[model samples]
Target chain A: MANVFHQRLDELDELLVDMARRVGEAIEHASAALLAIDTEAAAAIVAADEDLNALQFRVDDRIVELMTRYEPVATDLRFILAAVRISVDLERMGDLAKHVAKSVLLRAPAPAIPDSLREDFAGMGQAAVRISEKLVRVLAERDQMEATQLGLDDDVLDALQQRVHDQIPDLGYGPQVAVDAALLARFFERFGDHAVRISHQVVYLVTGDVHLDRS
Target chain B: MANVFHQRLDELDELLVDMARRVGEAIEHASAALLAIDTEAAAAIVAADEDLNALQFRVDDRIVELMTRYEPVATDLRFILAAVRISVDLERMGDLAKHVAKSVLLRAPAPAIPDSLREDFAGMGQAAVRISEKLVRVLAERDQMEATQLGLDDDVLDALQQRVHDQIPDLGYGPQVAVDAALLARFFERFGDHAVRISHQVVYLVTGDVHLDRS
Candidate 1:
């Protein structure tokens, strides 16, 4: 029974890693769609969000089933709870990616961000993707080292977001473009945030360190 | 043992209700700060968020303890899980409130939002407080009626957010104010979103329905 419980925990980790990978893809694709103003790709990212949502439901169901069948206690119970929280973060990251996609769709045929700001956004997108990739490793390996790196990566995303905000006024874009650019930067910043949150959960699970930053 | 377990569950509910009430106050205070351009009130809201974070930690400790002691199964198990999820939403609502307050602080002595957008923000603030009041009742009583009403309440918030967005471009505010206004509106919208999420968890606990809207 103990071995089986461990195996189930491993299975749960695999599911979380899978969700993180898809979130990374969604972020990458959404960024591409935004940069290229590819409405079709944006639509695909939006559509794929449903799959991530379904996956989160699956994770939740499996968690309940595990608790019902095994009645895991102490560390195992905490680990399961962390999995539930991690899935929420992963699902939210997917939604953030979808929000990015929707922004592209909102300005179809016309680029959502002005060219002056594209380089900063491209940097933000790359930072988001990098953070997500590290998040997948953190989930899969429970590596505290990788988990800590997510915070630094998120800091980079935050800086990029700030840069974008600073540049918006000088670009002389209209309100619609400015609003979209602000919101898009925010979406990427928030995507990195969820990744950091999931990594914090992993760190808590691995090190029993509960100093979570709920910012 | 079962009686004690049920009592512990009640204690958990009380903690959650307490958290909800504080979150409600945070939103009310933050909104007031935003409308008044009261930096002092904004600072208070920011400081108070730490209290909410501490409260969430308390709730989380209680939850882990309950699971450890009871190993609750089936419906009880699901209820506990829902509690975990609901606390997360409440904590996030507090964060959104803090974000509103921070926005006010960012432009201290000068309003973060222009005078023209004040009416819409006022409306958004009122709607947020109303939704939070309903959320407190939903958490305390598990009243599916109040829980369901949250959706409609959030609809009001979404509309208010939309109105704010529509007005932003026309306000002729520079990029900084425009960015701030856009983020402030998004913050309020997200607060409503979190409230709705908590209500959904309450409804699920009451009715065993799981058609959650993660949008």
Candidate 2:
């Protein structure tokens, strides 16, 4: 029975990493659609978010099942709980990606981003993609250092988000353009927040300690 | 042992509702602050959010402790899990309220919502307060029917949010005003989202079935 529980934990971990990869791909596509102005890719990302949601439900169902079967104790309990938290963060990240894609679709032929603001969004998109990719690594390797480093990247995204907000009055775009720029900036900032939360969850999983500052 | 477990569950439920009440108060203040441009009220809401966060941590710690001590199964297990989910949703709701307050703080003396947008936001804030108040009742009373009705309020909020987005171009506001209006619209939409999620979670707790549409 104990061996079965351990095996299931391993399987769940694998499933989590798989979910991360899919979510990362979604973010990557969102970034691409943002720059390329490809509604097709954006539409695809929007449709594909369901798969991630389905995946989360599966993860959640399994977590409940594992608890009922094994009644995980001590570190095992914490590990399972962390899986629940990480899965939620990943699922939210997926939704954020969908928001990015939907932003692209909303503007359609006009292109959501203005020419002058494109570089800032490109940088924000790049940082978002990088964070998503690294999230997979953090979950798979359980690398404490990697988890810690995620915060640094989050700062980069934050700065870019601030730049977007600061430049809004000065972006000198039309009303629709300004609105899209502001919303896009917020979406990227929120995406970065989820990444930071994932790292916090990972750190808790590894350290098994309630965080001080985060509290 | 059964009596002790039941007693603890009752205490946890009380704490959960208290948290809800606190969160609801936060939303009310945020709504008032948004329209009044009262930085003092807005700043107060921001500071008070940490207290809500602290309350959540306490709720979480207690849930874990209850689970560990009682080793709950079946309904008892589900109850504790629901507590965890509800606490998180409420914490997030509190944060959303803070964002509204922050929006007010961002503009300082300048009102966040223009005169034309004020009526729309007033309506949104009223509905939000109603939802938060109802959330308290739903949790405390275990009123599943009332929980289901929360969805109707969410729909109203969604429409208001749509109106905000639609009105941006025609509002004739400056670039900064447009940006704030768009983002504020989004914040209200997300606040409505958290309310619907709470309803879903309550339904799940009552029915013990996975939701069909959300996935």
Candidate 3:
């Protein structure tokens, strides 16, 4: 019975890990669509979000079921709770990607952001996606070191976001353009922060410690 | 033994209710300070935030302890989870209030906002605070009707925020002032949305239904 229960738990873990990976892919694809102004890719990211949301619901159900049926204790209980919270963060990340895609569709044909700003946005997007990927791996392997490293990477994204803000006026764009740039920068910064949150959850899962130099 | 456990749970609920009231009061006081540009009031609000944060930490710890100690089931489990989430929302509302106070301090003695736009901003702040207060009451009584009404009130705040946004450029402020006004509008809109979220949680707690009329 214990072996069977362990197998079931592993299966649930696999499902959640796949969902997190897909969320990261959606974020990256949506960023690409925004940069290329590709309506098709943007639409695809938007449509894919329903699947992510459904997966989140299913994962949550599974976690609750495990808690009730298996009565997991100690580390097992922590893992299940973390899984539920991480699923929420992942679902929100997917929603944020869809929001970015919608913004892309709103400004179709005419580029609201210039190439210089676009470079910073893309860099921030890639960093965010990388953090998400690293988070899944850390959770799957219970890797404390990689999880800690992901937290550090967030500072890089924050610095880049600050530079993007500083460059907004120098971009010499109109009011609407400047506003869009500022909002987009904010989105990227928030995305990075959410990624760090996931990484923090991973560290908690492994070490049973919630505080990790929040500075 | 069961009676003792029930009594403890009731105490936890009372503490949570108290925290919710404190959070609402903090937002209300902070908003008034911002509109009046009262630095002393803002400072007091900022100082009071430490108490809110300390209460939040205590509440979180108590919840975790209760969950681990009693291992509540079904509705009890759901209620505890919802309480945890609502506490987080309340903490965030407190932080938003602090941000508003910081903005007031940054602007100092003079009214940073123009007279023409003052009414719209005051309207938005008042709406946010009122909605927050309603949500706290809904949580205290678990009132479905009050929760739904608060959701509708949030819509009014949203519309007022839109008006503030439209009036931003016409206020004849410099670029920096325009940006600050835009961010201020956004902060109030977010505070309103947090109130809506609290209402949704209340509906869930009362009906065990997560799907609320978010429109």
Candidate 4:
């Protein structure tokens, strides 16, 4: 019975890691579409988000089944609770990626960002992608060190957001463009935050320490 | 055993309703600070958010304890899961309010929003508050009808967001103000979205139908 339970837990981890990887791909594709003004890639990213959402539902249902079947207590119970929370954060990260893709779709023929701000957005996208890659490994390995490092990676995204704000005044774009760019930057920044949040849940699962950063 | 479990469930519902009420107050205070440009009120709202976070932690801890103690299955387990999800949404609504308060603080002595878009924001705030109030009733009474109404209330917020976008071009404000106003509007719209999410969870709890609503 214990072996079967451990096997089920392993399967759950695999599903979550799969979700993390797809979220990274979504961010990368959305970023590419934004830079190239490719509406097709953006539309594909939007459609792919449903798969992430569906995976989250499957994770959640499996979790409920595990709880009902195992009646896990103490550390096992804590792990299950954290799994549900982590899935929520991962699902939200996918939604943020979809928001970025939709921004690309909205300005298909025209770039959503001005050329002056293009480099900053590229940097933002790269930061988000790197953080998500780290997230996939962290979820799969449950490495506390990597989980701690995810917070630092999120700082890079925050700095990029500040850079976008600093450059907005001089970007020479109209108010409409400025607003769109700011929102786009915010969506990426939020994506990084959710990644950090998932890592925090992992840390809690591993160490029983709840560091709920109120961001 | 069933009686005690039902009692604990009732207690959990009260805590969630309490959270809903406090979140409504936070949004109201944040909105007032934005319109009045009152830095003190904004500061108060930011500080008070910690209390909401604390309440969420307390609720979460109790949920884990309840699950462990009762090992609830079937409907009882589903109810517990929904409680945790609702607490998450309510906690996030409080954070959104804090974001609004911080925006007010960042532009203290100068209104974060220009006079031209003030009424749209006012309408947004009122819509958020009404939705929150309905959320409190829906949680306390498990009213699926009121829960369904929340999606419609959120539409009012979406329309106001559109109005802000429509008016931004001619507002004569610089790019910075336009971005600020736009992000602020997005923040409120997200707050409404979270409310709708909580309502959806309530509907699922009452009817066992999952309306994920990929917005």
Residue B25 in candidate 4, Cα distance off native in Å? 0.4
**Native contact fraction, candidates in order:** 0.66, 0.41, 0.00, 0.64
**Per-residue accuracy of model 4 over A68-134 as CA lDDT, tens digit each:** 8886767887877778878888889889888988998887788888888888889988888889889
Worst 10 residues of 3 chain B by lDDT: B169-178
Against the true structure, candidate 3 has what lDDT?
A: 0.73
Q: What is the lDDT of residue B87 in candidate 3?
A: 67
lDDT of 4 by residue, B90-207 (tens): 9899999999999999998899999988899999999999999899989999898898788888999999999998888888979999999999999999999999988888888888
Please tell me what DockQ candidate 1 reaches. Answer: 0.73
Is 3 or 4 the stronger prediction by TM-score? 4
Model 2: per-residue Cα lDDT over A8-84, one tens digit each: 89889988998899888998899889889999999999999998888888887787888888878867877776777
Ranked by DockQ from best down, the candidates are 4, 1, 2, 3
lDDT of 3 by residue, B129-206 (tens): 778778767877888888878878788878887787677546565544555666677777777777777678778778
TM-score of each: 0.98, 0.96, 0.90, 0.98
Tell me which of candidates 1 and 3 scores higher on TM-score. Answer: 1
Per-residue lDDT of A1-215 in model 3, one digit per residue for the tens?
Answer: 67776787887788778877887898888888878998888889889988887787677667667766665666676666567656656776787788788778888887646777888888878887877777778767867787777776677778887887677656665545656666666676667666677677777666667652212
Interface RMS for model 1: 1.3
- What CA RMSD would candidate 3 show? 2.7
Model 2, residue B66: distance off in Å is 1.3
Q: Please provide, for model 1 over B1-215, each residue's C-alpha lDDT reduced to its tens digit, 9 standing for 90 to 100.
A: 99998999899889999999999999999999999999999999999999999988988998898899876869888888998888889999999999999988888889989999888999999999999999999988888888878889899999998898888778877877877888899999999999888888878778888868797
